[model samples]
Target: MMLRQPCSWRMIIRTVTVIGLAIVTACASAPTRFYTLGTDAQPRITSSTASPSFRIEVRPVKVPTAVARSQLVVQINAAQVQVLEDDRWASSLPDEIRDALIARVNQQAGAPGAGTVAHGEDVPVYQIAVDVQRFESWPGSHVLIDVVWTVRTSADVETLTCHSAVREPVSDGYQALVGGHRRAIGVVAAQIAKVVRASAASATDSPLRFTGAAGKAAKGISCPHAADGAQAAADSAIAPLEE
Candidate 1:
């Protein structure tokens, strides 16, 4: 019987080192997944009958600093949060939100063009600014978004400020959580589209009517609910402020 000499200490150390390196390499090579708010699917909001004459320019969005990174930040508990390194946004959070809002608003409002004004063209431009006050993701529970948005034409004919808070229940996956946030954004877009459509109609009827601060105050437009398919059993509310 050949007695196997106890594995040499040097050999044991080398074997352990090689195993550790292999594990590290495997972990380092793990594929990262990226997500985007934009979707190719048909928009949920009902399209307007006439294409809007004015174009929409969605300004860059602002988000909380805690979730400003590319990685997905999720609330593990009331006091704890986790950042997933393997999952990231396709773009910065602000850019993602702005792009999503522009897409959904254009689709919902039936706007003719996006984010750009043709040189020397006499088309009205609606500038939409959004500030995200609270963006929370609770996986397997819900996703909440609190946003304050403002709409003003390039000519400054009228201004509308509104606040919207939407909370959507989600299932047990990251995809579902993202979907919930997408739907919440759609809800906000629907509210903004309502304002755009109304303003456009008013302008068509009387371009010079809503001109000064007094005229803007007299408009008294209330925030509207999410358009046809935009609301999905979500808790949402919109508060309009005359400006």
Candidate 2:
């Protein structure tokens, strides 16, 4: 004769039910925040005039020997990257911006005809070198991109030197930086294209042969430019590449 158990089957069933309910409640109450980014945020404008026919090569922006070697040079701080205090981050901006610029240029100037170099070729007629100086979010809620750039021949010879600065307001939040970056990149692409076109036109009309003046001047000059603070846009939307 065994003694009867105090707990009934119904009690055990109820206990299990309560435990399951608690687990479900906790999951439902938990926060599920999500982050997203856009492909193109800032506005883009193409020059009304025809884009330069010349194929220009763009190199990654680098810190010049003069500035890097100088003790007076100010370095980018880590806090600036994480918080995006300004739109200036070392190397990151150039890498990302360069990619975006390439996309925009390709879009603006449709695919090449026969006899053109393959896409993403290293060899190009004109070469562009950029120095970032003041890339940051400004007091007016605008992202300012200041770049000192020079154009040269394919052999890294100098042609012309010019400076350009663009200030675009940040309309979207963290999710839109990718798009925002693309928009900013479009501006840079257009500006560089214009400069290249002008230089090419000048060379054509000049009494003195081009003899690669573009490459020489660009090589000799070293200028400091701007970069932006770092902020990751996790959900960036990209448009499909056109055929």
Candidate 3:
């Protein structure tokens, strides 16, 4: 006859096995994926051709509390929202936007560089401020962004305030939504570059102050002008070949 096992030992062993299986199942079912809102900035400029006179002071981005967390926000409806557990931003949304803007403005615009506020930092000739009022996505539908930005300089009495709403279509996947947002940001970056180029044209000290954006559409720094027309409701492509 074999020695009998204690009931308590068997129960504990069974419980431990159940917990291990549960852990494995959960891990298998919900693997986390990280994403960022970065894309090839539109209207890119080669290093040799870069032309802008003003150095823009990029202020810290302002994001509302509603969508400030790391998780991806999905608007199920006007009254409801879903925060995905497995799909998330690689960094805080505001920080991601700030980094994206800093990198893109430097590459796509004529600015020498961009920087945050530092001790004893010299005053900047031109300044850029962005407020992200709304950023959300409907996974099966679209990614939407509503942002207002202000451009200020030492010379102008009135700042140029502009609002942009970008809606990019996406398939029924969080990855697609991420792609949409990246392209949407690229579009916004292009707009800011347009304005900065204009300001450079109006300056006196910087060498690029007299240079203009090289095209019919690029009428530099004409503030007190109206905003651009509404963008398409569903544009998924980020770095389009046409640009």
**Clashes in each model (backbone N, CA, C under 3 Å)?**
0, 30, 2
Order the candidate numbers by TM-score, best to worst: 1, 3, 2
lDDT of 1: 0.76
Q: TM-scores across all candidates? A: 0.81, 0.48, 0.72
User: All models: lDDT?
Assistant: 0.76, 0.46, 0.66
TM-score of 1: 0.81
Q: Cα deviation of 90 in candidate 2 (Å)? A: 15
Model 1, which residues run further than 4 Å from truth?
1-17, 44-52, 115-119, 208-217, 225-243
Which candidate model has the greater TM-score, 2 or 3? 3
Using TM-score as the measure, name the better of candidate 1 and candidate 2. 1
In Å, residue 189's CA in model 2 sits off its true spot by 1.6
Lowest lDDT block of 10, candidate 3? 209-218
Tens-place lDDT per residue, model 1, 8-30, is 99999999999999999999998
Task: Residues 1-243, candidate 3: write the lDDT tens digits.
Answer: 899976798899999999999999988987889998765433344222333345666788988787899998889898999888888899999988887776666555556654433424544476778999989888889998888877766554456667777787899888898888876776676677666655555344452222122212123444222233122111323235344
lDDT of model 3 at residue 115? 47
| Residue pairs with backbone atoms closer than 3 Å in model 3 (clashes) | 198-220, 198-221
Displacement of residue 229 (Cα, Å) in model 2 is 23
